[model samples]
Target: MRIETLGINHSAQEFLAEQNITKLYPPQADAVKAGLLEGQNILVAAPTASGKTLIAMLAMMEFLSTKQGKIVYLTPLRALASEKFSEFKKMEKLDFGRRIKAAISTGDFDSVDKESENADIVVLTNEKMDSLIRHGAEWVDKIGLVIADEVHLIGDKDRGPTLEVVLTKLKELPAKPQIVGLSATITNSNELAEWLGCKLVSSDWRPVPLAEGVFDGGTILWNNGDSDEIESSIRGPPIDLCLDTIKKGGQSLVFAETRTRSASLAAKGSDAVFKFLSDSEKKYLEEISQKILDNNEHTDLIKTLSSLLKKGVGFHHAGLNQNCREIVETEFRNGKIKLLASTPTLAAGVNLPARRVIISSIVRYDVKAGANKPISILEYKQLCGRAGRPQYDKFGEAIIVGNANSSDLTEYYINGTPEPIESQLADDKALRIHILSHIVSNPGIKGEEILGFFQKTLAGLQIRKNTLSFSIEIAKKFLLRENLIVQKAERFAATEFGKKVSMLYIDPITAIYFKRGLEAVSENNAHTFGFLHLVSSCEEFFPKFSLRNKDYETLSTLIENKSSELIEPISEYDCNRSLLALHSWISESSEIHLSDNLGIESGDMHRMVETADWLVYCLYELAKLAERADLLEELSTLRKRISYGIKQELVELVQIRGIGRVRARKLYDHGIRTVSDLQQIPVNKLAEIDKIGPTIADNIKSQLKKVR
Candidate 1:
C-alpha cells in the first residue's frame, strides 16, 4: 500500500517519502485496514523490522491532525526511549496538518515536567509515566494517543507489572486516549487485545525474512532445509560462525545467557575476528578502542573490552556503562564491528540488529529456581527477531548452538508457538507498590475502590477474581502495616509521609526501612559506612550481585567489625555485595579495586552507584520527614560522595558541575577544595591543571561566579 494513498495528510506522507518509505509493510497495511488511523485501539503483533513503529506514527499524525493533545509513546527501557525519541524527532518536520513537537522524559527523577506537556508527542519509560501520574502532572489529561513499543513486556516478571498498571491507568483516564501496542508475535494475542480493547493486527510479516536453524559441531541445519557446514575451530562453533558470517560480509550477534559468558565468548572470538578486519577498520577500531580506555576508568574489564574492540569484537550486558554500550551499539549498527556478543538486552527493544544471530545457549540459569530453565519460545523468538535488518540483508539467519538433535531443535524453537502474554500484576511486590500508588493518586480511595482498581488491571481480567482479591487484601495489609496508609471512616488516605513516599516513587517497604534506620541513627552513633549500608540495604537495589562463597568472608568481616554502627540487622536479602561495593566506592576506590576485591563489573558498579545515589536521596527525604535534622548534613554529604564516588573531603568541591572525582581530587591537591576555593583561582591558572581544559576551567569559574 502506498503511503500517499493512506490519507494521513501530505506532511506525514512527504516526510515518509523523504525517508524513502513510500509503501507500507503488509502488517502495517492490515493495521490501517483495522481503522488504526480512525483512532481505534490496536495491537500489532508481528516480527521485527515489520513497520510497527511506522504504524504508530500514522496513528499519531492522524490523531493530532484533528485532536488537541499529546501522544505519549512509552517504552520499556531507557535506551529504547532514546531510540524512539530520536526517531520521533523527524516528525517535527511534518508541517502538512499540524506542526509536530516531540520531547523525551526517561530520567529516574521526580518532576511534574511542565515544559514537556506542550509537546505534541512525549516519549517516556513506563516507570517515568507511572511517576508522572503519581506526581499528578497537569498533562495527564492532555494525552490523546499512547504508543507502547514492546508491549509484550507486560509478561516480563520484573518490568511487566509496572507496564500493566500504567496501561490500566491510561485506560481509566478521563481523556479515553486511543492506544497503539506493538509487540513481537505472541500466541495469545486475543487475550492482550481484549484487555486493551484493541483490534488485533497480527502477522508473520518481516521486511527481511528470517531463517531459523541450529548449529551442531560443524553443521548448521536451517529450518528452510538448507544446510551449511564449516571446519570447526578449536575455539568452538561460535567463533567458527563468526568467521563464516564475516566471510559472507555479514555480522553475527551471539546471545549468551549471562554477562560473564558473553564477555568470555567475545574474548574467544576476538583472535579469529581480528584476521578478517581490513587495515582501515582495524585503525578505526584501534582509535575508538583507545577513546574507550581513555574515556572510562582503566579497569581490567575496560582494558579487556577495549582490546577486543581492536579485534573487531564487542560484548554488551547491563554490566557495561551507558557510554560504552552506546559505542558498541553505534559501531555495530555501522557494521564496523563484525561480531557482537550480548545477553538478551537486545530483546528489550534495542535497535542493534545483525545479519545473523547465534544463540550460544538454549537454557539460562534461574537464580530463584536454582536451576537452568529452557528458554521460552517467546524469548527465543525475540532473540531471533534481531536476526534481520532492513535494506542490509536479503534475509536474516538465526542459529542456535545446542546439543539437541536437528529435528528437536526445529520443533522447539523454529516452529514452536510463542508463549502467551500473562499479567504479572498479582506479584506481591507489584501489588504492594501499585496499591499504594492508587490510594495516593486517588486520595481517599476506599478499600473497595482499591479492589476496583485491580479489577481494571490485566490481572483482574485474566486471573481468578477471588485470587486477585486475595492478593489485593494482602497488599493493603502490607501498606497499612508499613504505616503508608491509614483507614478513616471506611476510606483510605495516604498519610503525609505516605504521600511523600508515593511521590518519591519508592517501594512502601523501602520507606519503612528508611524510617527505622533514621530513628536508629538518631538515637545512636554511626559512620558513613553504616549510612551507606542503610541505603544499599533497601528494597530498591537492582543490578545487585549475589554474595558468592568468595564474597562471604570479606562481607562477614565487615559486618563483624561494624556491627555496632550498622542500623539494619543484616539478612540474606539485605544485599551485602552492594553495601561493600558502595562503601568502597564512596571511599574513592578505583574501578579496578572494586572489580578485583568485590567481583563487580564496572558497569554493574556504576549501576549500583546510581541505585544507591537515588536511595540515599530517598533516605534524606525520609530523614527530613522523620525530623532527624542532625542526619541531614550527613546525608547531603553522603549523597554527593556516592554520586561522584569520592570522599567526604571532596564532596564540597564535587558540587561544582563538570568536576567529577578525579578532577575534584586534582583541585583538592592544588589547594582548591570547594566552590569558595575555586573563586580564588583564574580560569587560565585552573586550565593549567591536568585534565581540566580551557573550556572546563571557564565552566568552573562561570559556575562560581553565578553562585557569587
Candidate 2:
C-alpha cells in the first residue's frame, strides 16, 4: 500500500518514502487496512526500521484528524522519544478539529516546559507517562490513542514494571484510548498480543531481504539458501571476518560483548578506514583526537568515535556519556557512519537502520558465571533484527563473524528462537512503593477496591481475578501487619508516619531500615553508605566472608582501607552489584581471571554499571525527599554532576540554572565565587556561560538583587 493512501499521512512519511520507503510492507499495510479508525488495539511485530514507526504515525495522524482526541506515543528510551519528537515536529499540519499541540514530554529536567495537557500529540517515555499519571498530570484525560513503540520492553526488569503498570493504568482510564504496540519480530507475538489484549499482526517480510552469512578467516561465506544449517557450515577468522563484510561495501553494525571491548574494536576498525575522509573532515577529526587528553569521558568517547568517523565507524555503549552516544547515533543514522560497534543494549530498542549486522562475538559475559557465555537466543534475534532497513537495503545481511568457533554463533542464530517474555513482577521495591501509594491514595478503599486496581495490571490480566483478589488480600494483611498502613474499624488512612513513608518514595522495608538507622546509628558516612549499599543490594549481597565467594573479602578489605574507589553507594535495588562490578572492571589490572572465580561476564558487569546508574538516581531522589530546600538544591547539583560527570557550564545550568559548576568554579578560581559573583560580574559575562538563557540570566540578576 502507498504510504500516501493513509488520509492523514504527513509529508514526513512522503519524505521518508522518497528517501527509500515508497511502499509499505505487508504488515504495515495490514495495520492500515485493519480498520484502525475504530480506535482498536493493534500489535505490530516486524523487523526494526521496517516502516513500523511510519505505520504508527499514520495511525496516529488518522486518529487526530478523524477522532476528537489526542495521541500519546510512548517509547522505552528518552533518546528515542526525543528523536521521534524531532521527527514528528516536521509535519505540515495536524488537525484534531480543534486546537492542536504537538510536544515531547519525557519528563527530563528540561521537560519542565512540557505542556501535555494541551498537546494533540505527545511523544514520551514509559517512565514519563508513569510519572505524569502518578503526579496527576491533568492532560492525561485528552489522550485518545497511545502508541507503545517497542512494547517488547515489557520484559525489561528495571523498567518493565513501570510500563506494565502504566498500561494497566491506561486501561482503567475512563476514556480507554486505543493501543498500538510496535516491536521487532519476536518468537511469541501471539502471547504478547493476548497479554496486551490486542489483535496480533506479525510478519517477517523486510522491505530488504536479509541475507544470513558467516565470515571465516578472510572469506565471506554466503548463505547457501539454507539458513537452518549455516551455523555448522561456517567457521571464520575473528575480527577480520567482519572487516571482510565492511570491505564489501555493506555498512555493518557489530555487537560486541562489552563496552571496553567495543571501544577497543572501533578504535582499531576506524583507524583502518580513517584515510577515506576529505582534508577538512580530517582536520575536524584531528580536533577530536586532540581533545581526548581532557579528563572528561565525553572527550575520550569523541576520540574513540573519531576513529569510526575517519573510517565511517562508531561505537555505542551505556558507558559513553549520553551526549556522546547521541552524537554517534545521529551520525550513524544519517549513513555517515559505515560501521558501529555497540553493546547489546542497543539491540533492546533503538532504531538505527543498518545495511548489515554482524555478531562479532557471541560469547557475552554473565556476572553470575563471571565468564563469557553465549548470547541468549532472544538477544541474538533482537541484534539480528537490525540487519535490514526496510527502505534502504535491497537485502540486509546478518553475519555471525567469529574465529574458528563461528559454528557457535551460527548455531545460536539459526536455531535460536526468541525467548518467552517473562513477567518480572517480582517483589520489587519500586512496585512495593507503588502499591503503598495506591493504598494511601484510595484511603478507606480496601480489599475489592484495591484488588480491582491490581486486576487491571499485566500481572492481573495474566492471572485470574480471584487469584489477584486473594493476592491483594494477602498483600493488605502483610502491609497492615508490618504497619505500612493502619486500618481502624471501617476506615483507613495512612498514619502520620505512613504519610511520611509514602512521601519518601521508598520501599516499606527500606523505610524500616532507615528508621532503624535513625535509632541505632549516628549521621555518619559508615551509617549512611553502609545502609544505602545494603538497601541497594536487595537482590543479592554475599555475607561478609567465610571463604566462599572470596570476593567478599576483597570488598571488605577495600571498605576497610577506605579505598578512594568506593564512592557513596547509591541506595537502590541494584546498586550493590553495580558498585562491585564497577570496582572489579576498573580496579587494578589483574591476570587473575574473574571468570574463573566469580563467574561474572564483562557484559553482565556493564549491565551492573547501568543498573547502578539508575540506583544512583533513585538515591538522589531519596536524598531530595527532605523538606530542607538548601539540601535539595545541593542534591540537584550533585545529580547534574552525575549526569555530565563534569563541572562544565552545562552541568552548572543543570545544577542551578543561569550558573553551573564550571562558571561557579571559574568564579571560585578567580576568587569571585557564590551568588555574590553574579552581583560582581557584568551581566554579559554571566550570559557568556553555557546554557544561560535570558530568563535564567534575568533570574540570576534578580537573585543577586535580593542577596545585595
Candidate 3:
C-alpha cells in the first residue's frame, strides 16, 4: 500500500507524501495489484473519499514518466474540471525535470484550442472533449490515457450519451490508449468493465465511516438497530437536525429538493446558527456577506442569501452567480459556516463535504411528470457520500427527515444497492447529433460501418442487436431527410452543410430550424424580432419563458404586431415571452431591468442571452451557406447587436476595444455615434462621460488610431 511500492517515480512519491497520501486505501491497492502501473485499463468503482483521485493520479504519473503523449482528464462539470486543473498544475513544481503544462477547455466551444494540443496534461468537460473530436483536433489520436471522472453519469439523460460516445470514439483510435473510469459504486461495474475491456476494482471502503439513519419524532433510528434522541430547538425537521449537529460542534450540509426550499431552510436555521458564532466570527461573516452583494443589484433572492450568511449559514443552487457560489463554498470548506443548505447541484461533484448531511426530503418535482417523484438510489447515495470528508470527521452522519413513508425510504436508500448505470445513448435526439458528428469527422466511414461503430458502445451492448440496429437506422434516416447526411450507393457522407453544422457544435435540429427560417425570409421581411423568434423557437434555446397572467396582454400585443414577419407563427405564450425578452435585451436593457419586468433571475437572463448569441452566430453561418445575400447583412448586424446587447446603430462602436454597450450608448447620446466621431474627440473630453475613465478613453483612442 506504500506509494513507493507502486512503481511510481521517486519524485511522484515525494509529491504524494507532501499531499499526506503516502498510503493507499484498500481499493487503490487492489488497482495497483491489478497492473494499473503497467498501463492496464481500469474501472474503479468505490465509495466517495476512498482515494479514487489519487489512484488515477498514480496511473497518469507513471504513464507520463515513460511516455511522450498527453493525459486527457475528462470531467462531467466545469467546476470539477477547474478543480482538477489546479491540482495537476502542482505537478509542475515537483522535481520531475520536465515541463508539465496543464490546460483546461470547457465552455469555449467556438474557439479552436491549439494550446491543449501541446499540453502534457489536459483537463476538459465531456462536452468540450466531444466537440474537439468533432472538430478533428489532431492531438486526440496521440492521447496516451483518458481519465473519466464521475463515469457513472453514463446513465444521465442529458449528458451521459456524450460521455459514452466519447469513450467509444477514443477506444476506436489506432493508438488504443489506456482508459481509467472513476465512478461511484454501482450495481453493474463488471458489465461496464467488460464493455470497456478493462479490469474492475469495486469496493465499499471509506476512509471515514458513514452512519445512515432516519429521523422521526425527535429520534433518529440508526441502521445498526441503535437510536439517538435529538432535542428540537427549531420548528421544522430540517432546522431541528441542523441545530442538533451544530450543538455537537460539527458543520452540517442540508440537502433540499428545490432552490426555494434550500433558501427557506437556511433562513429558518440561521436563528439557531447565530447562537454559535463569536463576535469575530460574526464580523467575518458580515464581510463575506458584503462580498456576495458587492456590485450587484439588490434582488429579493440576493437579500435572503446575504441575510443567511450574516448568521454563518448560506444556500447554494444554480440561481446564484458563479462568484457567489465560490465564496460560499470556500467559506464552508474553511469551517466558518455552521450549516449550508443546497440543492442537488453540489452533489453532482464539487468536493464540498461536511461532518453531517441532512436530507430534507427524498422527493423532487419532476417537470416532465408534472408531479413530485422519489429520487433514484444512485442520486441518494451521491448525496450521502458528501457526509464524510477525509481528514475531518471520525464518522460522518447522514440523517433523513422521516415522514409517513420512512420505512420505504430506509429500505430503498439506506439499505439498498445502487441501480445499474444504463446507457442513455439509445435516445433519438442523442443519436442524431452524435451520429452526424461521427460521420462528419470521419469522412472515410461508410454506411455499412456506421452500425459496426455503434456496436462498440454501451448502448449497443445493452440493447438487443435488432433493436440497436433499428434505432441506428431510424437516426440515419432522419439525418438524411434533414439533408445533414447523404447516401451514394453503399457509402454515407456528410453534406457541406452538415460538416459546417457539426463543426459549429450545435444540435442538428437547431440547424434545421435556421435553414427553414432563412428559406422563408425575404429581403423586405427581415427584421430583428423575426430572427430572435427563430432562434428562441429552436430546441437548443427552449423552455424560454413562463408566461404569467399579467404579462399575457403585453406579449399578445407584441406577437400581433410582428405576425407577418415571424418565421414560425407565435402561437404559444412562452414563445412570445421569449421574443419580448430578447427584444428588450438587444434594445440595451440592463439585467436588473429585465429581472424586474420579465420576472427572470439574473442567472437565467445571462443563460438566455448566451444561448441566443450562439444561435444567432449559427444562423449567420447558415445564411452564408444558403447564399442569401439579402439576409447576410441583416444577420451580421443582428449578430453584433446580440453579442454586445446593443441597438443596431451601436454595433460598429461596440466592436472596438474598451467600448461596451453602455459606453456605446453614452457616445451615441453625446452625438459621437461612430468610430469617426470617436477619433475626432479628445481623450480628456471622452473621459468626462459617466462611467468612462481616463485609461479606457486612452485605450479607445489607441484602437481607433490603429483602425485608421
Candidate 4:
C-alpha cells in the first residue's frame, strides 16, 4: 500500500517518493495495510534502517488525525529519542495543513516542565514517560497513541520494569489507546504481540535481499544453497571472515569486546586507509579536527581522535564521551570514515547500517573476574541485526571472528537466536514501591481486594502458591497495620497513610531505610557515622564505585591513612569487595581471589556496581519523598565525590542557591561556616566558587550583619 492510499494523502507519499522511497519495505507495507491506519495496535518486526520508523510515523499521523489526543513515540535511549525527534520534524513539515507540533523530552530538567505540556506529538524516552504517568501529569489524558520503539528492550532488568509498568498503566487508561511495538525480529514475537494485544507482522523479507555467507580460508561461502564457495579476499584479509565482505564493495562493522580494543582496531586501520584519501580528502579530515577541538573538551583521547581524523578513520565507544561518539558516528555514516570498531553499546538501537557485521569477540571483559567471557546470544543477535538495511543494499553480511574452530563460529552466529524475554518482576524493591504507590494513589479499600492487581503483573506470574496470602503479607508491610488499609464491610480501603505512600511511589521498606539513613546522617555525630554508612551502603546495597589503577596494595595504604578518622577499621575483605565493585561500575574489570580453589569473576564486579548506582538513585529520590532533604543532599554530595563531572557542580549550585544549609556550610567552611562566617571571607576568593560573582559576594557580605 502506498502512503497516500492509507488516508494519509499524496503529499506524504510524494514526500517519501521524492527521497526515492517509492515503495515500502515488506514490514512497512504490511503494517499500513493491517489496519494501522484504522488506529489498530501494531507490532512490526523488521531489521534496522528498514523504514520501520516510517511505518510508525504513518501510524502516529493516522491516530492524530482520527483522534483528539497527542501521540507519544517512546524510545529506550535519550539518543534514540533525539533521533526520533529529528525524524518526526520532517513528517511534521510534510503534514499538509495539519501541523503536528513535536518536541523531545530528554535534555535539561526544565524540558520536563516545558515541552510535555503542549506537545501534539511528543517524543520522549521510556523513563521520562514512566515518571510522567506515575506523577499523574495533566497531559497524560491528551495522549491518544504510544509507539514503543525497540519494544524488545522490555527484557532489560533495569529498564524493563519501567516499560512493563508504563504499558500496564496505558492499558488502564479510559480510552485504551492504540499501541505500536517495533523491534528487529526477536525469538518470541508472537508472545510479545499477545501480551500487548496487537497483530504480529513478522517477516524475514527485506526490500534489499540479504545474502548470508561465511568466509572459510579466504573464500566467501554464500548460504544460498550454493555447493560452491566464491573466491575473494579484496576486502582486506580473510583473517576475520568480514574482511572478504569488505573487499566486495561492502562496509563491515566489527564489534570489539572492549572499548580499548575498539580504539586499537580503529587506530590500526587508520594508517592503512590514509593512503586511500586524496589531499582534499585529508583537508576535509582537518576540518573535522578543527570542529572537534572547537566543540568538545580537550581530552587526550579527543586530541588522538583529531589526529586519526586526518587519515579518514576513527573508532567509537562510551569512554570517548557523548560528543566524540556523535562525531565518529556522523562521520562514519557520511562515509567520511570507514569501518567503525565499537562495543555492544553502539548496537543499542543506533541507526548505523553496514553491509557486513563482524563479531570480533563474542566474549566481553568480565570486570569482576578481570578477563573476557562469552556474551549472551541475545546480544549477538542485536549486533548482527545492524547488517542488511532494507531498500539500500542487495545483501547484508554477519560474520563471527573466532579461533581455529570455524564450525563453532557458525553455531554461535548462524544457529543462535535471541534469548527469552524475562520479567524483572522478581525485583523486591521495585515491586514493593510501585505496588504501594498504586494502592495509595487510587481509591482502594482492602488488601485482599487489590490482590488481583498483583496477579496482573509479571511478578504475579511467578506466584507458585498462595498468591493472595503472599500479596497480603507484602501489602501489610507497605500499608502498615494501623496505617490506612481497613477491612470495611468485607471490602478493604486505603487509609490516609496508604494514600500518601502511593503518591510517594517508593517501597515502604526502602522508605523506612531512607529515614534511617537520613536520621543517622543528620545527627551531631553524623560526620563520622556518615562515612561508615556510605561505605557499608557501597559494600552491600548501593552501587559500588570502582577506582581503577588503585590496586589492593594502594587501597590498603589509603585505608590505613584514614583508619583513625573512619568510624570503623577497614579490612582486607572490605577493600577487595569495594574495589571490585568500583572497577565493574567504570568498566574496568580485574580478577581477585575468593577462596583456595575458586576466584571471584571480573565482569560481575561492574554488574554489581551498575546495580548499586541504580539503587542509590532510587533511594536518594525516596529520601526526598520522605522529606529528608538534608540527608538526600548529604548523600548526593558523597555520590558526587565518587563520580566527578560538570553535572555535579550544577547540582551543587542548585543545592546552595539561597538561604540553604549547603550555602551556610560553604560559608562556614570558608571561615564563614555560619551566617557570621559570611562576614569574614576575603571577597576575592569567593568568586572562584562557581555562580557567586564579586557582586553577589558583596551582597552576601552585606547580609552578614543580620546574623543572630
Separate clash counts for every candidate? 1, 20, 0, 32
Q: Is candidate 1 or candidate 4 better by lDDT?
A: 1
Give candidates' CA RMSD values in order: 2.1, 7.1, 2.0, 7.4
**Whole-model lDDT, model 3:** 0.86
lDDT per residue for candidate 3 within 445-524, as digits (tens), equals 77668888888999988998899889889999999998998988878889999999988888898888789888888676
| lDDT assessment of candidate 2 | 0.61
Per-residue lDDT of candidate 2, residues 511-606 (tens digit): 655444334433323332343354335442221112345555655665666433233432222233334443443332121233344544433433
Worst 10 residues of 1 by lDDT: 567-576
Instruction: Give, for candidate 4, the lowest lDDT window spanning 10 residues.
Output: 588-597
Q: Write down the lDDT of every candidate, Cα atoms only.
A: 0.86, 0.61, 0.86, 0.62
Runs of candidate 2 with Cα error greater than 4 angstroms are 3-22, 95-99, 108-114, 215-238, 275-308, 368-371, 402-412, 426-431, 461-478, 488-508, 518-658, 681-708
The TM-scores, one per candidate, come to: 0.96, 0.76, 0.96, 0.76
Candidate 1 lDDT, tens digit per residue, 263-344? 9999999988888889999999999899999888787888989999999999999878888999999999999999999998
Q: After superposition, which runs of candidate 1 have C-alpha atoms over 4 Å from their true positions? A: 96-99, 523-526, 548-553, 556-564, 568-575, 682-684
* Cα deviation of 212, candidate 1, in Å: 1.0
Looking at candidate 3, what is the lDDT of residue 223?
A: 86
Which segments of candidate 4 are over 4 A away from where they belong?
14-20, 94-99, 107-112, 214-220, 225-249, 293-300, 365-373, 389-392, 443-445, 457-513, 522-708
